[model samples]
Target chain A: MGARQTLGAVTDSDSSKAKRATARGRLLPANQEFAVFATVAVCFVAMALTMPSFLTLGNMFALTRGISVLGILALGMGIVVIARGIDLSQVAVLASTCGITVVLLNNGIPAPVALGAGLFIAIGIGCLNGLLIAFVEIPALFATLATGLLTLGATRALVLPQLIVYLGPENAWLQQFGGNLSIGLPIPVIVFAVVALVMHVFLVHTVLGRSIYAQGDNPETAWLTGMPVRPMIVTEYALSSAIGYIGGLVMVASTSLMHLQIADSSLIFDVILVVVLGGISLTGGRGGVSSVIAGTLLIGILLNGMTLLNLDTQTQNIIRGAVLLAAIVVDSLLHPHDEETSKQGL
Target chain B: MGINLSKRLPAIAAGAALSILAGSAMTLAANITRDTSRQAFDTAISGKKVAWVPLWMGVLESEWTGIMKDQFGQYGISLVTRDPNFNNDAQLQAVSQLIDEKPDVLIVQNNSTTLLAKELKRASDAGIYVVQMNMASNYVGDAYVGVDYTQAGHQVADELIKQCGGGKTSGEVALILGEATAAPSIEGLKAITDGLKKDPTVKIVSSQPGDWDANKANQIATTVLQQYPKLCAIHGFWGPMAAGAAQAVKNAGRQGDVKVFAISDGQMGDCDLVEQGLFTKALSNRADVQGITLVNAVLSLLQGKDKPGDKHLFYFTNNYWIESAKDRGYCYKVDKAK
Candidate 1:
């Protein structure tokens, strides 16, 4: 009887050990990004195999260039969301500043000075958003929404009453940013790549970056642990605004103008969609530049393909909204939050 | 007896003088009546009130407002304008309120065909004369003064066919619409589709909506260009929006190869773009002329001769094709003060 009991105990211990090993593997395996990246790859391969025109150099370049601006904005939004915040005003900030830049340039201001003024305004608005959310105890969602309306309204009233500013002929140098590089790649795509690399390094290697994650994970705990959680929140939003300005520049470069009407369009929602669709959980504290790139790529490919297929806007929007809903559902299932993990302010 | 004779002689002299004066006065009155109809003119035109509700006060609508205000003011009529700023609900509210105020004329530019249909019917039933501009609604108002977009579309497509139709080019064409459901856009698309059917060689490779956005046009046009490098011509619904597609073609270094056509509100910006060779050919409906037409329609309706909704009058203004620098006059200049 003792021998039999010993054998049974050994078997039980072995089974428990195997179970623990598998659980650890599940915890640390290729993350949500891997799944998204895989999906992108599969779509790309399928598109290339089926659509004869999809593999062409011109089409490939166009696809990348089209997505470059969206990718950049998604990256910025991802950073803010990683720190458990949202930015509904990113597009408004971008449109207003870009309009100001063009209006200044058209008035004979030098391109460099005009560009600086635009970036400065964008960052200022972003910091203002941060101040409202962090210092005034306002929710990011409501604060950013109000800030966006205020920014657009003020810009429209004070500067671009016409709401559309076209780049002048003298601004060829400014327009080059939207053009091609010597290597036959779009400059915007190159800009997007460089921005992504820098962001990846900043998030993965820096102390402040880790703090953003911790703060997003549990802001109260992070504050108790001596992190300057408030300042970190400000920095996150400021960065988002600054990067959104870059995306605006790309947009202006590509189109040779800026239409402030975009402030009221679905662009901000699209940015958020791409960010979250790539597995950037809105509940906060997860996702990086890779997730943004994956999201951008998937969206880019889908849009490019749909355009090729000549689908109408309504059909396209329906598919896009469905995909976003599915992504949100999947995110909730994968990153289940208990009562303790929910942010205090939320 | 001597007194009576003297009195009679004085009376006869006075009678002759009175006859001469009365004859001259009658002749003068007859001439004046033959030359002028002052009372009728005053009753028809002077001291009227007109209320205009536009979709928004953009360059085009503002131009219309400036023209209307100036002309109506000159006619001794009071004009009130409410700018809805592209919000349909606000437009509906403005129309309803203006109807209640009971202005002699209520002119509206509908954002959609049905959004203001009920309100317009209410205005007409309330004995208010209604004028619809640029876009018409299902409830036809008293008078409609705008471009016949279907004809404009045919003009644009015909121009495209001239450049890209029978063996002149690769025959691959694309169309960019402003909005899918907008009456102007839908009628224009249908007309272009029908017009393109005339030339079997020309094949429409892609037809998409830009949603009246320049950037969206640029993006879609860029992708279409990539898919069809040998694309012969591209047509867009509006000039300002089509300018983006032109920019795309220019960016692709295919500006000279691709002929771009559009029916645009002939704003100065459209002229500038055409002069810069961004657009190949533009069928411009002179907004300035259309604005004048709107004022004239108001004048005709307010002659106090017709009941509300009694006259279904339409003033289909002509469209001009802007092809070269010399055709710049076809596009109207927007006043800065407006």
Candidate 2:
């Protein structure tokens, strides 16, 4: 979720092309993002009318901070989805690896070393998922699903036999990752914003990022143009894991505990939901940072408003399910299934 | 379930003054042959196979298992165990298979009240005495060894009222409960509400389900704290999830100001949180001590001649309030080496 993509980023060479596309494609993901933003605004207005607490500054900060983890995760998921892939193992990898980091820290290891080890393992798992899908020719669905279980099982057997890993008191400063800045913004929200900015620049301004789009659009065509498609897919998954780790760290800082049970819970589904709800298509090669931000905001608003109203879990789930269904319907109408998308069968 | 939270809990209860006596049996002396009662106890318990199926082996379950294993080993009872990990379907399958094995007694830590109700009934029907631990199901086993959660809930509510009500601070309290259908969240909530009825000043502004996840609890806590900056206290149904709520209070710069409480299954980490001042207090269901109670339940079930379904018994483990370092004993240590 980056700052809404602006025309200012368009150079002379791409400006005409961008403007022409922007004009015809109110049907584009950006337009979809606009629709999402409008929906969020509408939700905010409605909630503000009914729930006097909703528009308060404290609640506003809370809403933004609370969505940071989901927003960060959705950004990573956005990258992978843009590359015509999915990583069901994202939560598993993040929880295990980050939990391992806390495990190390609790065991008296230095912070950097613990974090480094966790990062290394996270990237390794991501690479494994990439290799399986790209080289072994396994579908992303089965590959990531299998790897998710494997990661969880291996983690349980090796380090985290229990479901949670509590951060040690000696390393209490690590909590700063989730603490607020002087300006009242949470560190996690800032991190989410920074990550989104970097992702947006990478996606729009980098050769590797451009190649990812081409590869996602059509692997055969991209391969014909010598785009190093396989390696790019590997990079996308690896990057996704790296970003997911950051989100996990923020989560740990906020909660002071990482319960690996999240991997078993419906959390990964929530991550994927945020990603897809933000305009990232399962059919792939669509949506961007702005899309993710829009989706996260809408969800964040919905969740915050519900909690302020003290809605029960079942009611929240029903509302979430309804919103998700509506988004899917809106998405399909905007990006009609073609030969390729139909083949993908999202 | 450190579900990888932390490796804690040493042999906290093994050598404690845990009197393992059930029915006519008494604690055996060192010289067993000199005592006919010891011999009789040995005869009744020895060679008996007790099978256990937990939701998953979390710190609480492990603590109970360790005590059971050591005691059962000494008594010559063969304890068969299955770990379904966390899958409800797998738990059902394992219970079915264990029932077929026809162990003398079957112990299950039900994930939900209904998931294993029928299986428990079938096990009882199969002549296998059933022992339900921590949480009970619809089908009453031969014996149950855990908290009378409604009573526990009343205690929690009373504690919350004492800490936050009577216009002490902001009487607004938030509850981050476990899974909605779980006994702790459902019955515990109702009882807490029932208890809170005594305090007209106390207001429960938000009661959200954390689904027993710390992160979910943290998010909900953050929002609730924001909505009521003067929120006097936050109560969580479980410790790990409450840690998240505690952190949110800390993040919001309201640690001592916003009291945080959890009804914890006395894990070392739960105690550690109290020691660190993250939690104002915790109502610890002494899991380590519960292990002794669990062993007693199983032994009684074995020695009794009544039919499984006919001899319905409930052993409510006493709960302790963990407020300081001295109360840390209430929390069990994990068998990290194991």
Candidate 3:
């Protein structure tokens, strides 16, 4: 497995350790999520004090809406990351599957059936990825990357050879999902919330979710303990792909068109950034749903503020990179690696 | 007639035949110029190699390639096209390899202003007629044929001013750019910035790079709208990308109130947007006619005796303002069968 070198992953989250971490102070929390939330709060306060428009209801909706699709994708990425794996194909899968769904819709397929077919294709790709990573024993990163490319090429050849697929007016129902609610909540933000809540429940309250953590904590012991790790691997990837499809649909709804070139964009990196920024370890087994939400909000706030300031992309990217690096450094300082984990080196 | 009938008949017959021969000879002389021109064109264009490297075979590039094949193939010109698929390095490699083949003409559509600048210059230095189509590089090659992006941008800004500037509405316009480094974005913004100088009331509230991704444009527009609720208009650099901004405005329920403008290569989708009122205006760059312009540029270069890279021969493409259904011809229909 191409397990990347990351910081000493906290494989245990026992209450004793949590109480001790709490005793340490308000400066450090039991996990990465609290620190991220605090960061968002402080930044929000700082920004609001300076800019009158920063705290408006409409701006809040705009900020959340901007990151909702990314947050949705990160939810899936979070699941895969939790299982000690990475899926580079999330963006690619979404781009192609969503484009195909629109094509079907244009060809007189009912919205449910067409959308379901797209979901089916996405799950199929996820299975292929899991098969390669689990049964074939390839690295998850390479497996998903290849499958993503294959899916994009196949979709282009079979359905959307053109780079863009515009939504027809007959499918106006789908566009409604992109609209904002009367209460000023963009539908995408609500979609992210529902998906996040479901994902949080799945991770916190289910046997399969616990098994994913166990599997990521120690794969060999998990298998020896009768966890059926291989099947779980397939399930997580399918979940990832399926969630990615939903995000893609939202993208279609929001944009009124899907540009296949998005697969070629840097969107996947941003999704992973949202996941990892909130402390989802690449080595896995440590983070949870709060981590994903925190990450989304942090990135969303930063991006929203930058947009409001009218900063250039380069400056925004620089600030983003520096903040991520600084956060990681601060995290490492706060939670120094133990000798055993350092020697094991993931 | 009584003296020598047969002899006189011979003379008269010869005279009539002489006059008819003279008449036919004049007709032949009149046809010679047209025949020679065609012959000259065939001689100049036939057996010549034209290598076209599009930024990638997207819709516009494909349309150009299709037209070139149908026209160039007729004149016995062999066209070798390499689609870099929007990758700059691959494009550079393709142009370099084509230059090595010493084609009589090289037509390239650049994705960047400088990716192929060196290669284009080298090709010209090697005596290959380099014609940059639609998008050109920083190093001016021989005979550039593409949009007068500045003029197009000025016209668009002037239109925006009429609709939104000079106390027309909010005087707030946002520009959703693709790549700031791209020629279209750079020139368009420059011209728009300059155009706004004439009307100080027309303030550009926010300009951001959407990177030509519709989703990005959507997100940016959503945020900008929140920041400037009364944003009068938005100008998206390209049609497909701007479609996102239009949708964002529509999502904000400002479809007719907040105008959206886009510059498109007349992809029917853009025209469809205008027809549906999603887009307030579209500056249509007719790629179909642009293909003809490109062909003529190649033909002119091939027939001329001037050395490659000696001087610039440029053709600024025509821009048609598409606002209503009557201007549908400004848009070119794509073969979905492709």
lDDT of 1 by residue, A1-346 (tens): 1232233334454666445434433553326677678878998999999999898998989898888999999999998998889999999999999999999998999879999999999989889988889999899999999999999989988987767777887785776888777665888899999999999999989999888888877788899999988878788889999999999988888777788878877788889988988878787777889899988988999988988989887898898888787777666545543343344552
lDDT rank, highest first? 3, 2, 1
- State fnat for each of the candidate structures: 0.51, 0.90, 0.85
- For model 2, residues A226-323, the per-residue Cα lDDT tens digits are 88777787888899899999999999999888888888888778778887877777877677899899999998999888888899888988999899
Supply the DockQ value of model 2. 0.69
Candidate 1 regions exceeding 4 Å error are A1-30, A344-346, B1-47
TM-scores, one per candidate: 0.88, 0.91, 0.90
Candidate 3 lDDT, tens digit per residue, A209-259? 888988877787789988888888999999999999999999999988999
Model 3, residue A103: C-alpha shift (Å):
1.1
Best by lDDT: 3
Query: Against the correct fold, how does model 3 do in TM-score?
Result: 0.90
lDDT of 2 at B298: 74
Estimate the lDDT of model 2: 0.83
What lDDT score goes with residue A239 in model 3?
Answer: 97
Full ranking by DockQ = 2, 3, 1
